[model samples]
Target: MPAFAIAAEDPATPDIAALIGQHLAEMHACSPACKVHAMPAARLAQTDVTFYAARVDGALAAVGALKALDATAGEIKSMRAADEWRGTGAGPAILAHILREARARGYRWVGLETGRHPVFGPAQRLYAAHGFRECAPFAGYVSDDFSLCMGLPLA
Candidate 1:
């Protein structure tokens, strides 16, 4: 089996597409109609967005992306871990890898939007542990009761 690795690889791969679709579906199911902010695979394929897949033993375990909101800021988008890999380190590993990528790209800040539903508690905690604090609406986001926005400022 190949060692676990993350790369800006093919988001068109079936496994990656299925995982991202599940993520968007769950978001739409949990949040109100206007608050469903998950991006589609086609949007993530744009030049400003860098999509990554975490692979374990050659199987796709998780997927995420960093979308340049502007020159100094980037947003974490479409972050989802496959069901079988939830409890594994795949989520955090992918998150950490993306943050490093954001920093390398000269972003002074990183932000994300996640559902406020109870089901998202673990995800909220994961971002909090990595220094992303609850913050106001950013970029094109508007304040909504069902959404929680978080941001971390880099040195």
Candidate 2:
């Protein structure tokens, strides 16, 4: 098996649902309630978003989505790595996969929104390691104390 493998998956899969639920709950818990921007399973299933589930050694490792923002860019939403898989690089693997997908689809950039809480420090580090640098809000999000955005240009 490869060091990291990813595949397209149904956003509504029961396993994916549980991961996303936990992600949303954690986001809401650590930040102002209205600042949580996690996408629900239903919304993740929309045509504009391509969702993925990743596994390692046959165990569910994580889930994420690449949401099309326009012809030239996409937003990564709902990134969640199962607690058991954190620090094991599963989430970053999914992020690398999302970037590959963006490149394949001719997107010049990929961006994401995460929390500003201390609890999110690791997440910030992960994105930074992948070349996702902080940027102004790109989609519907805005500048706020609790919300931060990052973008990586593919080309």
Return the TM-score for each candidate structure: 0.95, 0.95
- Candidate 2, which segments miss by more than 4 Å at Cα? none
- Clashing residue pairs in candidate 2 are none
Q: Which stretches in model 1 have alpha-carbon errors above 4 Å?
A: 1-3
Can you write out model 1's per-residue Cα lDDT over 1-155, one digit (the tens) per residue?
A: 23459999767788888888888889878888788888888888989999999998788888999999999999999888899888888889999999999989899999999888987899999999999999999887875678889999987
Score each candidate by Cα lDDT. Answer: 0.88, 0.88
lDDT of 2 by residue, 34-129 (tens): 898899999999999999989976678988899999999999998888998888888888988988899999999889999889989998999999
